[model samples]
Target: MGGPVERPVPEDSAPEQSAADVAPVTVGQGSVDSPSGVERHGMFGVAGSGDTSGFGGLVREPWTAPGAQRPYGSYFDEIVDGLYEAYADAAAAITKVVVERNELTLHIAREHLIGVATALRNDPSLRFELCSSVSGVDYLGSTHRLHSVAHLTSMTYRRRVRLEVSVSVDDPHLPSLTGLYPGTDWQERETYDMFGIIYDGHPSLTRILMPDDWDGHPQRKDYPLGGVPIQYKGATIPPPDERRAYK
Candidate 1:
């Protein structure tokens, strides 16, 4: 048919701004759309000042991971092939596969976590026996703000792989891996305690590090850093907000 579409690139003469100089950007509501259809929200650099420092010319673009191409090299290819063959019925669950820094990470859909995990552990060819760790990450700006990471280890093959699942903060529910790996019991609790991700089938999912009445998930980026002021030897020490601060 026709030739491929070409996109225009910004000129070098255009001003740039550093990430630190950029204000927090909210998407979709008031964001400005570029000619290429990418949304640009929030201003960078000093609002009303002229650039004198070299860093003032730096602009920050959105962060995204590039797709990895096959042959993925080494055992990564075998693992993917095995997984695909084993979970052929649930193919949609495996969203993306990434190979970075000699590691393989599978970005899985939240709803398919349990099924994928089960397949990884039981399939003879892909015997990922151990669920080493479970952790959480809050991607501050994206639509899927909460991410749960599960590190899997194959004791039989001496290999490791990571499984990642992303969900919206509004409905942070994931299928608990406790049924597949009992060690994940406490780890899941700890993640829920700090990141507010609710593992639906976790047994006794409660505060592991924080007190039972803790107000918020402490590790989330949007969580407040300071709480009530500390009292030392009957003297009042103000909370972080009341103390002197520097930008």
Candidate 2:
């Protein structure tokens, strides 16, 4: 009883954080954090030309942002709580939550899109009644290449949040949100046209920006650069939207 007894815990008995619980992040001194969990080889400069400038030799590895820690500042905590209270499978539905640049984004699984959307819209405390926009992105290097994003707005609470769902290019399908937010009809269509993300229950998933028989998604990273040339350097080019045959 001199002062206090200290004991050393065996390394085997001590608690250890598993890799699953770890959220990886890369922070630069004065640069923005991208927070995507994918790495890719990228060329910095000299597009379609030999490396005369040497800038093309450089590869940029953008920082990957970390998942939000507990007690997310501002009303993010309340929003999360409300979602948990409203959705029975909230834990499984919410794949990850990231707070960055003063915005809240919830990465949701595609399977639970409707359930989470319903909860966010109908639940009083988490009344995300409006989906301002629905967009698609191709994180080319990631396992899930296609990403569908919806920006939600709460008119009553004046809060805005984002929901993202990702799926592999081989099996790209997400349930439509037009049933919940009618405004997302054309937005989802445009996204489908641009990135080829098929909204499963969409009223009309036809291409909005391109012809019905358009070949591939124009905005995708792997899409060939074949569109009409706009006299960039007096270079003659062919159109990219060559009709594609559907099986």
Candidate 3:
């Protein structure tokens, strides 16, 4: 069995200390079905009415994803080193390196995405042969609100790594990985369709799930919840936005 890998401590950072001295970083928050904040009674243009649901008193606090500490054991060290050696020129493009839950995640800048992907695949030491999935996330309160995530697997080493790139919602374009991994075509499109993230070099980035005539990305946090009326069993129901929900 391989011994635990020791990570290189940054010279500029503080001296290495016990794990107890390090504060844990928050990663993700509430799930899509149950987000953190409660929708106000009248905030969505409904008439002013007191909420009767017991959840009305609920309040949510914002939490940011924090970077993880090093000594990221197992094969994480080898993978990071291989990537650094393979793409020396793009070294500066890396923003953060996180190893958590026995997984390695590389936070890369948008401009260097293609180069990084190429190196991750072609580099002999880091033969990440498969680009497993492409997905997107909307960090509602983050400065760079949109995040594109790619999962890569190295069959030879039986290892997996995640590449993440963030972009502001205003300028939501990132270079496409279709050139490297053809399977990402539909996945990227779906992510774009749902999150409004544009893959710059995508051959045809039309909506995969939503209709072409859809007005807006439905998955965005700020998107209107409900306005259209629903009819079932000859009964009319207000749109989700207009309905009385937890405040």
What is the overall TM-score of model 1 with all chains considered together?
0.72
- CA lDDT of every candidate: 0.70, 0.72, 0.71
Candidate 1 lDDT over residue span 168-244, tens digit each = 67778777888788899999999999999988767799999999999999988778765454567766565553453
lDDT of 2 by residue, 1-247 (tens): 1321233323452112222332221222122222343432233322465665544545556355578998899989989998999888888778788899889999887667788887788777777768888898777765566789899998768889999877767777778887777788899999989998888777888888899998889888778876565768875555433332111
Off by over 4 Å in 3: 1-59, 227-247
Residue 86, model 3: lDDT of 82
Q: List the candidate numbers ranked by TM-score, top first.
A: 2, 1, 3
TM-score per candidate, chains pooled: 0.72, 0.73, 0.72
Question: In angstroms, how far off is 31's CA in candidate 2?
Answer: 25
**Candidate 3 global CA lDDT score:** 0.71
Q: What lDDT is obtained when candidate 1 is compared to the true structure? A: 0.70
Minimum summed lDDT over a 10-residue window in model 3 is located at 25-34
**Clash pairs detected, candidate 1:** 16-57, 16-58, 17-58, 17-59
Where is model 1 more than 4 Å wrong at Cα?
1-54, 227-247
